[model samples]
Target: MLKDDQFWISDDKAKLDMSVIKGYLARSYWAGQRLEEIIERSVQNSLCYGIYRAEGQVGFARVVTDDATIYYLCDVFIDEEFRGMGLGKKLVQYITQSERFRNIPGMLGTRDAHELYEQFEFRRDGDILMRRRPDHMRS
Candidate 1:
């Protein structure tokens, strides 16, 4: 987990530091399986992947949306060197503005970050969402 500092997510059209971004992805759990594979899968699946860089890559997130009225936001991460700087919140803001996600119902999971999501109007309605881990992955 990233410490609470030195990170910032941006919606600006700034040049991305791909090398650093790749480094972070390479160290991620499931994503570390293969950077090329992960990038390709994200593109093919129509998932929007965002990376935060400050001196290096500090955060990442992917949004699954249909360019319509429903969006499943997932896989948000902030590198250990960068956290608590609002990068994750900024990334969510950036993704929500897309024509595909604007006005759509968005959802995500977080062991933490409930406060950040609250700023975007995300709420826990008990009936709003649920999940089941793959049987094979369950302990």
Candidate 2:
């Protein structure tokens, strides 16, 4: 867990609010078409992080790892109402610098937020990132 002023981030899955997560993902272009069941299952299988203010859950990010070599960071977001407050940066920094992931290579995909991840050493490598939209997300 990490704290920044009035906001805090936790990896305890028990603290995540499904409604809040679902609400955001349902509108996310990368996950908009994903089913609720799939979301739940994904959360269960990965290392989940939730950002919160006293009001409630406000941000989220998840990493899929083998507990050995590499990791894939995805589904990262800071609530629309809290976008400029730096919660997203704090969340990414905490996770990336953690003892387990600090020196390990990882990858993340973003169509436009490349600048944010670049600060943490995630560079743009076309070969490292690829895409195949789900059937429903394709036109």
Candidate 3:
């Protein structure tokens, strides 16, 4: 959990507003074609963080991990209206600094947002990130 004034980020799945999450991802360039069921299942299986303001959920992030060794950060987003408020940075900070994630190697792939992730020390290496999704899964 993390708080700043009226905004906060929480790992509690119960705090997640699925409509807000699905609505955002439904229009996102990366996940626009994803079905709600897939999103729900992904959320259910990962450690998710929801960023909220007084009104409701405004951002989200998730980490796929085994609670040890490796972790992958994905599906991070802050509502358009909420961007540029530094909430995104706070979300990254909260996740990377949390006791449970300390010292664990984390990975993420992004065509954009490299500068933001770099602030948390995420970097590009010579090795490529490979995937084996079905042909239909390619976006």
Point out the higher-scoring one by lDDT: 1 or 3. Answer: 3
Which should have the higher TM-score, number 1 or number 2?
2
Q: By TM-score, how accurate is candidate 1?
A: 0.59
Residue-level lDDT of model 2, residues 1-139, one tens digit each, is: 8886799999999999999999899999899999999999999999999999889999999999885567889999988989998888999888887887876677888887877887777778783462222222233
- Separately for all candidates shown, the number of backbone clashes (residues 3 or more apart, or on different chains) is 2, 0, 0
Q: Could you say which candidate leads in TM-score? A: 2
- Judging by lDDT against the true structure, name the best candidate: 2
Write down the worst ten-residue block by lDDT for model 3. 130-139
lDDT-better candidate, 2 vs 3: 2
Off by over 4 Å in 1: 1-43, 127-139
Candidate 2 wrong stretches, greater than 4 Å = 127-139
In model 1, residue pairs whose N, Cα or C atoms come closer than 3 Å (at least 3 residues apart or on different chains), thus clashing, are: 2-80, 67-100
Candidate 1 has its poorest 10 consecutive residues by lDDT at: 130-139
Candidate 2 to truth, TM: 0.89
Instruction: Give the TM-score comparing model 3 with the true structure, all chains together.
Output: 0.88
Quickly count the clashes in candidate 3: 0
